[model samples]
Target: MPITEVFKEEMGIGGVLGLLWFQRSWPKYSCQFIEMCLMVTADHGPAVSGAHNTIISARAGKDLVSSLSSGLLTFGDWFGGALDAAAKMFSKAFDSGIISMEFVNKMKKEGKLIMGIGHRVKSINNPDMRVEILKDCQTAFPRHLAARLFTGSGEDHHFKEAKSYPECERFHWRRICGHA
Candidate 1:
């Protein structure tokens, strides 16, 4: 290869590979924006999953790591899964070419949970705060693809219209939950 081609191949391929290798060693070296966001969200309140675990561990006289790990492990298919559900629901709705009530009904039949619809806490059932935060993230980092992934599927409208069982929307906000 010519000198220019050789340099391009090495710099283009090697640079990305080198960065990936270095990332494992510098997990805390995220940009200032992400670090700041993490700090901002660190202690929103005890209702969050991590707070629940820490409180449980402290009360039980267990160590901090164990308690935190207990809480982290609990964040699946229930506590932390709502956002993922919403993302999937939006994807489905977007792919189907409509964010209408019909799309929601079809997805419900297919077992896709709507994201950001209902909350365990916050009786108002508003997801706009979370949306605003995400919009802020998008503003800060214009290249974020997840921002583009938001299909604006009219999920909020469908959720508000579809009456669900009270128990279905109820989230257990207890401090000390048993192991899964």
Candidate 2:
């Protein structure tokens, strides 16, 4: 059903949104993933193209919806576009029955970057708190680990080790057991 059908129900807006997502038959715990994405996108603020454009539009006297749409239009496959790119890449690889390593290799061979495989400010040393927070939801959103592991470039060894989030729970488990 469309969100319009969902909005017809006399329920909380969150409930309506959740129902719409659930109806679309995404992941098992998709609402949590959606919530996380919403929080991240909302906090991006004016630094990103979409939010910056939205600010410009609002300042130029556009209505709220128009400003929002204008901002959205700036979210093409480069700026503010990683989520869509990652999804498309992952889906294509999955549909082709390729493993993560194979997909990484293909991209490397073709001189293409994996859409969600690297980051600028985040790294193994300093780390990103946003990624740390999102790690708890890895079981619900395994796809996001693609964003967390910041390889300077997609090296073969790192990509091999990162085929799955094997260490996510183990690190926390060790810490809990006074082993960290």
Candidate 3:
């Protein structure tokens, strides 16, 4: 088969992100969700570490490639590194059958700080609008239906087992983003 034909067969026209498009059975909103995620995380502002580093490097007469590399290098533990830690922590807690309150208690007891649970300016009363936008999109999408179904008895054994955790119901991305 021709490479183009093979590409079409395997990935379809919108298969630039293999993971998102891997399953032909995915809901239509799946692509939209991926896009929303990308949009939200694309950039915070020039004050952020990566952008600041890039600006500094450029002002120092660095080339575009070097400046970009310097910016990316700033994305370690102190900068834009909390997402991976948060994902792992949440996954571990969920897999271990821990509730949200219990997880919070354990982290507190261990003197471990939750990575994605605070913002410099946003508070519970005044949440970030970007998070609100993403939450609204999620609610409108069919994936919200799937999330609901996943909270109950579903054919997906993993989800079915996970439904027992009350945290799963309350744990929205908005909450996490707002917490930070």
Highest-TM-score candidate: 2
In candidate 3, what are the lDDT values of residues 68-160, reduced to their tens digit? 999998886667767767888899999999999999999999978776778635778888778888768745644343445445543334544
**How does each model score on TM-score?**
0.25, 0.34, 0.33
Per-candidate RMSD vs. true structure? 21.6, 19.1, 16.2
Under the 3 Å rule for N, CA and C atoms, how many clashes does model 2 have?
A: 0
Worst 10 residues of 3 by lDDT: 171-180
Error of 3 at 122 (Å): 6.1
Collision pairs in model 2: none
lDDT of 1 by residue, 1-180 (tens): 344744665534333333444422111212334444555565445347756776788789988788788877767664677777777878877897985788878857987545678654444564436556745654454222222223234233333345321221221101011111
Please report the TM-score between candidate 2 and the true structure: 0.34
Candidates arranged by TM-score, highest first = 2, 3, 1
lDDT per prediction?
0.50, 0.62, 0.62
Pick out the ten consecutive residues of candidate 2 with the lowest summed lDDT.
169-178
Range of the 10 consecutive residues with the lowest summed lDDT in candidate 1: 171-180
